[model samples]
Structures are given as C-alpha cells and as structure tokens.
Target: MNRLTIAAIAVAVLLVTAASSLFTVQQTQQVLITQFGQPIRVIREPGLHAKIPFIQSVIALDRRLLDFEASGEEVILGDQRRLIVDSFTRYRITDPLLYFQTAGVAENGIRGRLASIVSSALRRVLGNEALLNVLSVDRLRIMNEIRDQVNREAKRFGVDVEDVRIRRADLPEENTQAVLSRMQSERERVAREARAEGAEQGARIRAAADRDRTVLLAEATSNADILRGQGEQEAIAISAAAFEKDPDFFRFWRSMQAYREAFSEGGDSRLLLSPDSEFFRYFRELPTVTP
Candidate 1:
C-alpha cells in the first residue's frame, strides 16, 4: 500500500478508539463503569467521562425521577372487603453501584424490582386498614405510610422512593351494583324521614291555626251577644222614661206603632177585636185639648 493510504488507515483506527473510550454524561444521567459485568466506579456528576475501550464499559442511568406503576391487584382489607388497587410510584436511583449490583444495569430490571417492592408495601399497609379508611379522606396518610415502607425497602436496591400514590381504588365490578343499591336505599330512608318530619310540623301548625280560629270566633260571638243585650236594656230604659214623661202621648204613640206594624205591607192580614180593647183604644176616640 501507498504511504498516504496507510496513514489514512492509521488515523481511522485512532478515531474509533477515541470514540469508544469517551462517553458524555448528560445533566439528567448518571453512569456506571463496569469491567466484565462487575461495577468498578459510579459517575454521578454530569460531564464528559472516559472508560477503557473494550475492557471497561459505561452504563448510563437516568438521574431524574422515574415513574413506576403497579398492575391492578385485588386485596382483602381488615373488614374482609375486597378492593382493586392500582398504584404509581416516583423514585430515583440514589446509588448507582448498589443499583447495578441489585437490579443490574438495565431499566427493566430496576422497574421490576421497584414494582415488586411497592406492591409489597401496599399490601402490608393497606391490609391492616378497613375499607372505609382506605377510601376516606385520610387516604393521604395511608399513602405516606406506604411511601415510608417502600423507601425503607428500596434503600437496599439503591432506590429512593420519593412518593407512592394509589392511582385508583375501587370495589370489584360484581360488588359495584350492590353498593349502589345500598346507597340508594340509605338516601331513600333519609328522604322519607325528612318528609315525615315536615308533614308532622305542618300538621301541628294547621291544628294550632284551627284552634285559634275557633277561639276567635267564639269570643267574637260572645262579644256580639253582650252588645245586643246592652242595646236592648238601653232601649227599654229610654222607652220607660218617655212613658213617664207623658202617659197619654206614650199610649197614643204605642198604639199607633202597633196599628202601623199590624197593617203595614200586609194586604191579606185582618184582625177582629172588641171596641174597648187596648189595641183599639186610640181608634175609639180622639183626646180633647185644653186651651
């Protein structure tokens, strides 16, 4: 071969060696240097890193948070109720050496181990709680407990469990309809009690109103009777006073009133009496006047 071609071949080999010996550590990545499947050193800071071309290898790990989700699982609670729980976890690889030893350098292995740890934590913590507590507002506290437990177990795997949360917690499909029916029955019972209480109050108010109306009417009737009796007494006293003032005029007025009342608007009315009867006294003769 020519000298220039040999030099070109030599330069190509050097570039390949340089490329294989150098790897970039990104801001979001941590790397592990492994020799023949044995981790030798861990690189946490971000920058350019180097390893042996063929003997030492670089295993890049994500330094940022990772998400892990557990499959939906049915668990029995302390109350003997069944719940299907789906959970999610957020974690980070804290120690790359321990992570490589425990979970290997692959993402799948890390995820598998973490998911198992989270599931066990969930089962242990939630199994002791009643179903109501699992579904209540205190679920935040339950999640914290699960996180604490997962973190404790995850440290062995060089993982930091930042947060653990239940994605969904629900009854089995077979039990859903029964739970709905019970809730509906409870609501109906409450409605019935409310309606009964309202009707009772309404009836009490109506009865009190009726009693008050009856009492008011009775009092009004009694007052009217007393007024009528007083008016009749006043009329009798006035008539007696007039009669005492002039006996002849009073008798004449009384007889005239009786005659008018007996004949007024009575075209078919007739009465027969003696000539000297008191009822006909005014008609028998006119009184003489002295000058």
Candidate 2:
C-alpha cells in the first residue's frame, strides 16, 4: 500500500477509536462501566463521559422514577377473606454499583428481584389487615407500610422504592357471587322483619279501633234504649193522668186510634167478631165528647 492509503486507513482507525471512547450520559440516565464483562464504576452525573474503546463497555440505566406493575396475587386477609390484589410500584435506581453486582446492568435485570420483594411485602402487610381496613381510609397507611417494607428489601438490589399502591382489589370470582348472595339474603331478612313488625302494628291498631267502635256503638244503643224506656214511662204516666181527668173520653180516644189502625191502607187482616164483643163496644155505643 502507498503511504497516502496507509495514512487514510490509520485516520479511519483513530476516528473509530475516538467515537467508541466517547459516550453521552443523558439527564435521565445513569451509566455503569464494565471492564471485560466486570462492572468497574457507575456514572450518575449527566455529561460527556469516556471509557476504553473495546475492553470496557458502558451500560446505560434510567435514573428517573420507573414504574413496575405487579401481576394480581391472591391474599387471605385477617378476616379470612380471600382477595385478588393487583399492585404497582414506583422506584429509582439509587445504587447502580450494587445494582450491577446483584441485578446486573440491564434495567430489566432488576425486575424479577424487585417483583419478588414487592410481592413479599404485600403478603406480609396485607395478611394482617382486615378487608374493611383494606377498603377504607386506612388503605393509605397500609400502602405506606408496604412501600417501606419493599424499600428495605429492595435496597440490596440497589433500588429505592418510592411508592407502592394497590391498583385494584377484589374477591375471587368464586367468592364474588357468594358474597353478593349473602348480602342480598341479609337485606331480604331485614325487609321481612320490618314488614312483619309493620303488619303487627297495623293489626294492633285495627284491633284497638274495632274495639272502640263496638264499645261506642253499644254505649249509644244502650243510651237510646234507656231514653226510649223513660219516654214510654212518661207517656204511660201522662196517659194515666189523662184517664183520671176523663175516663170515658180516654177510652173513646183509644177506640178511635184502634179503629183507624185496623182500617189503615196496606193492612192484611180479617177479623170475625160478635157485635157484643168488648172491642166493638165503642162501635155499638158512641162515647160522649167533653168540651
């Protein structure tokens, strides 16, 4: 090869070496430098960085907050109720060197270990909590406890757990229908009891009203009978007084009333009597009228 051609090849080699030796660390990334497949150091500052071209390689990891969604896990609560829990975690790589040693350099390398730690924390914390507590305002405190426990375990994996939260929690499919049925039955029992009590009250009220109406009617009828007896007695006394005043006139007036009643319209009566009968004495001899 000529000198110009050799020099051109050399320049190309130098350019390639220069390009391989340089790397840019972004604001959102942290890089781990490895020599011959062994981690040497971690670079967290954002700027231009350099390393040996071929022997040393760089692994870039995200330093910003990352999200991990955990698969749904079934847990038994303190109340012995089974729940399927779906959770998510927010984390950051706080120690890249430790992460490289334990979890390797890839960001995905830590997922398995972190997931296990999160799951363990969830089981431990939720196992002691009742379903009511899990579903109530105390859920925030429960999540904090889970985050703290996960963080403690995650530190060994070079991850700092920022938050842990349950995205959803529900009874298992088999238990869901059972729980609903129980609730419906309970409500129905309450309604039945209420209806029975209302019926009893209504019956009692009706009984009381019926008793009062019967008593009132009986009392009114008794009072009317008493008044009618007194009126009859007064009429008898007045008639006796009128008889004492004029005995013949009273007898004649009584006979005239009897004759009118016997001959009244719509009467169905046939009387066969002798002319000398006492009933016909007024007909035979008319009583004298007194002025």
Q: Give all candidates' CA lDDT scores.
A: 0.91, 0.93
Instruction: Tally clashes: model 2.
Output: 0
State the TM-score for model 1: 0.73
TM-score of 2: 0.66
Those runs of model 1 whose alpha carbons end farther than 4 Å from true positions after fitting are 212-291
Cα error of candidate 2 at position 257, Å: 38
Flag regions of model 2 displaced more than 4 Å.
190-291
Best by TM-score: 1
Instruction: Show the colliding residue pairs in model 2.
Output: none
lDDT of 1 at 62: 90
lDDT of 2 by residue, 56-119 (tens): 9999988989999999999989889999999999999988888888998665778888888888
Per lDDT, the best of the predicted structures is 2
